[model samples]
Target: MVPTMVLVADDSQDTDRKEALRDLADAVAERGEAPVVRAFGSGSEVRRAVHSVEGPMVVVPAFVAGGDFASAQLFAGLDLEGRFDACPTAPLGAVPSMVADLAGRLSASGWTDGDGVVLAADGSTGQDERQAVTDVARMLSRRLGSPVQVGYLNSWAPSVGDAVERLQRNGRERVAVAAWRLVEDRDYDRLHEMGAASVTAPLWPSEIVVDSLLAQHRAAKARLAA
Candidate 1:
């Protein structure tokens, strides 16, 4: 079977963005589906491609920092509902579902109870970003059947390392960290340096989730495949 193709749109040409998209593409491909990953350097480019793509395509926005509003507007401007199934960059409401999905992935990856923590940061300084983190943490905790704390790297609160230390000091056996922000090489290196494991949520690209966008993309993909 031919795998689904997902288009990744971002304004920056940075390495972090590229890696995140690749990770997502790999995840989709691992589902036994084909994926054609396309990167856009601007919203205009993304908008244009949205019209040109022939099949179902997941539009992943590269706006990780503070451009969510603009990204949201661009997605909205495309009137995706009229033409395609759009899955926006992030979908926090799907955190519970994502947590369930993560549980399986973590278990497969050798994660055990009380051994991992979900780490997320609101790098965009947007109110929704913080809420998204909290939502994912809550869902993960529920799904894991234990308390899973969330920490922000950019906040005044304890850093990722500090969070790990606290968990270790409290006698947690294995500790893993998950972030919603762009998983840059430095970020991954830092997680390794801190002795914490990390995983990124598939639904919340860049730690943000816009449900309408996700629905659109999913619908478009289904329509094309059908």
Candidate 2:
């Protein structure tokens, strides 16, 4: 069966991360799937571009410093709530061991050696986030007997596009992006376009995750009462 095609739209015009996005696109193409990954510096451009395509497509916004407005506009333009199912979103702290365990699970579930990308947030410079990613990379490397690359959501840490570039530089054939914030359909679409698979921690915790869950629970109770 032909895999679904996806499009990635982000707002980073002149960054070096374009290489990573290209690597991701190549990975998807190699999967015998048709994924079209494209990046734009503005949500308006992406929105216009997507309308020209038919069938299902995913869009991912690059993590801008403090602008979710574009993301929100993208979501509205796409009517995401009506189009795709919402996956639970979670924020995770530095948990190297847990990440390693999750990597193992991904492997068991059919991720091939060096065919994975872990997306993490830019650890505050003095924080353990960076260390956690490094440790997990080491663990995954040992498990796969090959080096595993890490990507960051924001530009502060190594960007996801940058990590993808590094993997390409190392000649990795296929890659999957395991990230926390890629839960939205748009994000998933971005990964698909880049030719990278997307996965996240199941029990990872984050403010958004917690709030969404709680809201759901309350809604369920209200429905029951009604």
> How accurate locally, in lDDT, is each candidate?
0.53, 0.44
TM-score per candidate, chains pooled: 0.56, 0.39
As a whole number from 0 to 100, the lDDT of residue 226 in candidate 1 is 71
Model 2 lDDT, residue 63, Cα: 28
Local accuracy of candidate 1 as per-residue lDDT tens digits, 1-226: 3324444445344566566655654554454434555545466776666666665456555433322333334544554676444444452333454456556655665667768575544334455655666676677777778777665554535666777778888888677766444335344444556666645433334222333334445555565567
Clashes of each: 21, 7
- Residue pairs in clash, model 2: 20-165, 24-194, 25-194, 28-195, 58-189, 59-186, 91-205
Q: Every model's Cα RMSD, please?
A: 7.0, 13.8
Best model per TM-score? 1
Q: Provide the lDDT at 161 for model 2.
A: 69
